[model samples]
Target chain A: MTSHIDTCGLSCPQPVLLFLTALRKTEAKEFDVLVDNEVSRENVTRAAENHGCHVTAHQEGNDVTRLHIAKN
Target chain B: MKSLRNIFVSPAGIILTGAIIGLLAILLQHYGNPGNMGICVVCFNRDIAGGIGLHRASVVQYLRPEIMGMLLGAFVAALFFGDFRARGGSSPITRFLLGVIASIGALVFLGCPWRAILRLAGGDGNALFGFAGIFVGVGIGTLFFRQGFSLGRNTTQHRASGFVMPLIMLALVLLYLLYPPIAGQEKNGVLFYSLKGPGAAHAPFLLSIGIGLLVGFLAQRSRFCTMGAIRDVILFRHWHLALGLAAMLLAALVANVALGSFKPGFEGQPIAHTQSLWNFLGMVTAGLAFALAGGCPGRQIFMAGEGDNDAAVFILGLIVGAALSHNFDMASSPAGIAANGAVAAIGGLVICLLIGITNIRRGA
Candidate 1:
């Protein structure tokens, strides 16, 4: 199963909080996170790794980025 | 919505709005608030602290409805705009400790980031040193941020947890309204009003409250923060936040001129000190703490209102820190820092540096 988290238009801790919420709801092997900036994507990806996940990132535009994290 | 968005959505727009807010504060001061201080988050909070019997600074005690109103106003606006959501459990303790340190640093210099600007507008030359200190502090914090330093992560909790800070603000408003201080007995009620000094001077209750609400609402929407402005410039070389900050300074400068309040000197400034070294050190500590904590005092208040419980805790820590500053004689005066303030300031910087360096991953 795959779960998705959207952290667009949020700032600082909000994106982190939203990612945490989505992570708690997922028991899936894969997670898709959408963020609107590089900083948020980096933070999210770092957080995922801290929680024992592997991340692959893709940038769509100046303000859009996606991260796919695989859970062990 | 369009007009409001125009005033607050862009970086320049938000800075202009912040400047207007600063100017309004000046006009408000001209009409009533003492010492040309129209809006001061730390001084007002200290006054509020006195009003609630948290301290006994007679000349600085007031049941400032504006402070309470800022939070409540923001709370209402956030709810109406679909922005309210309570969450916390992040390194709440750490954030709170940072708040305490931030407030102590501000009091040691006798003002928060906003008051530092307002003091300068009023011709307090001392603020120039404070401004420099803030830059140095932000520079240090930026280094830590670049190294991947974070206080910790926040976890979601029950919605009621978010309302605690707003509810406390509501309670303050109620205290102000019901326990109207008796004439000549300003300290008799559950709320106190200043009889003299900066605490006595204030914009009309309703006017101050209204402005507080407006600023709170707009700031929440735009994510405006003075520290963030400086930090963005130092860290990512971003100008979005810097534009807002520059706007605030320019607007305030213009407003002071129009109001005949611009003095352009370091001496005879209200609620300010002339010890150049401490002014620089004081703001450096505050700036660094704000950088680590991630917002200015005003921004922290607005964040607290928007259901960020960790922010609220930080604010509470500030209040307590103010009380402690006074009780321990660590706060500064117009004359300057107390006898031992210099030593404390240096100690603070060293401690902050230690925290910054140690918290980063060794290689990262």
Candidate 2:
């Protein structure tokens, strides 16, 4: 039910980009993305919805966060 | 429920707040923005570049802390709010190239999207033509996007990749603080600041930086982008982006009126020219390049602050292009476009179109 993408060290367009690619590869009902920054979180979240996915996000530490995106 | 909460509560709030902040920027500039400009992403960047000794356009050189503050403020906000992430490697070189071209286009036209609006608000009839050109350019880019045009996807990289831009901005701020511009000196520090001219004109450092930070924080939250607004409407008939753009124009108009900075004719506009065709062509070139590159100059700067190395490269490209513009006589003056400006604009359009067409997958 869950899939993961490690985007810890990517930049603006790429993190969102990799998330999109990961979305294409997974049919998991829920997806969790591990990112190292807030901008990527926003970008990924936006990209997810643009492709019809819903996202929920939570911060874990100074340099890490988890984004939960569900395929709608 | 959380997604909607974040969307409606955060991003929407950010958009509205950002518009208000933009209004404040106009007001601040009207009262005194160090010069005639209230907010100019490109010109300010050029000033920062000049302060660092990148080029010598004496009348328009200063180490603008607002530029540094934009990146740093965004950095702090992202860090504070748990948003700072550093990831890159998606067509960085291409992004840098696009940035350079975009800057050249902007300089040729003599301003970025924000300046275009400011010019219009100040009663510069020339900006009307420039806005029209921007639409045409964006329309072409939309055609390309529809054709499946893409610069290529980026892959994940190291955290250090993301920190590069912020560090550079920090260094610029340090230089500005340590080596304040001296009157009648060729070498002030790494760069030169004009004792007078447009370079000398600037809002107070702290005030400018404060405004920059406020704008950065709000814009980061809002996802407000000028190009995105036009692109969204063209692609999806969405008005969310359009609303923000309208808000900016409206805010500037009202603020300019209140400040008595609203001039009503094309003649004698500040830092602008009246060559209608070039104005249109210049922005057309700028608009296409911005669309292809993926954001407006301001948006790109905010993105760079949030660890977008590609966007950082684009920002650098703009800085370099600004230097190149003055060095090579490619930039426009209030008098008009330089001799080769039109040719360069046409060349840019051709190159962009070529890239757009070649990269598109025919049946994707």
Candidate 3:
């Protein structure tokens, strides 16, 4: 199963915290994290990696980033 | 098997790190983190010291769980990714002294590097002086680096050294949780609270700590550092970190406008003084010490989480220095620079210069 976290309209650290919170509750092995800014992308990617996930793919849109993180 | 830094190992990674923090700082202010101060390392440290009874600065006392969160967040991230390593032994005393000098300098200016940038984005013109001072201070540190100024080598230590700081962070968190802010009062158990003034203003406790943890986790992985940004530019002509700082500044500016918090002026700024000279000198002193110490206060906390006991000692010095500043009336207020802040800034400059002069090698 995959989990999705939408962090649009939020600020830095918030997006990161939300991502971490999602990681804590999910039993899934994959996460799709969406953020609207550069900082959040960096943070989500980092947060995923910190929790033993690997950034498998990332997509960039006009103002949003969708990250695919999978457990190692 | 893994490390978090890999995710944010590129230029884009670092820039995003800065941008996110900048945006959040403004948003946090929009909610309630103080006017133009979202994540001031110096001020937060002072507040922590006040909360712990290090000094009796009546108005500014609270056990900011945000700071505690940063340490713990970094610790958790490092541990999860197997990057946590206990190390120390690089002129520990010298680093501590540098932290004290840096805190004093920041007190004179009433902001750290993060707050200085935020102040400008919020339309405080006086921050221009601070920016100037920061550059000049980094410039001096660069000269020393060119001369082979090194803080000695770090040696691996017992794992317990690393856990000590994390445990302290955990203990602080427990303290904050146990002693909720007293109803309509500033005293909560062993912890102190602020009923009024800038100290009284804050984001919700959970929000602040949650943000702090996120920042800590991300910063640890990205190796986000303000001092290193300028230092890299001066020494290597590298702009990766600089770009991050720029992005952060731009993001904050945009966020401030969106939130209707951008007020342009040199006077009547909240918790700020109009003494341009002091602002410049204050940053100069603080910046130099940060460079000499190899990181800013924010970076220090991150380093401390990674098992740098020396960095932890430096943080301790900062807390004590905050106490000393408040106790001695050396911190600035909206009214003006503190009574002896001028002399203290000058003294900090002297100390930093001496450290730079003596530590540098003729040839590496």
Best by TM-score: 2
Count of backbone clashes for each model? 6, 18, 0
Identify the leading candidate in terms of lDDT: 3
Q: Which pairs clash inside model 1? A: B33-B201, B33-B202, B90-B154, B123-B264, B125-B265, B125-B266
**Model 1 lDDT tens row, B202-303:** 777788787788777767766667887787666545566567666667777788888787888777777777888888998899889888787888888887
Docking class of 1: incorrect
Instruction: Give the Cα lDDT of each candidate.
Output: 0.74, 0.74, 0.82
Every model's DockQ = 0.07, 0.15, 0.02
Return the candidate ranking by DockQ, descending: 2, 1, 3
User: Candidate 2 on B200-234: residue-level lDDT in tens?
Assistant: 77777778778878777767666667887787677
lDDT of 2 by residue, A10-62 (tens): 43334554566567765778888887755567667767777898888788776
For each candidate in turn, the TM-score is 0.83, 0.83, 0.82
* Residues A6-47 of candidate 3: C-alpha lDDT, one tens digit per residue: 766442234554566567766988888877544456656756
After superposition, which runs of candidate 1 have C-alpha atoms over 4 Å from their true positions? A1-72, B1-7, B361-364
Q: What is the full ranking by lDDT, best candidate first?
A: 3, 2, 1
lDDT value, candidate 3, whole model: 0.82
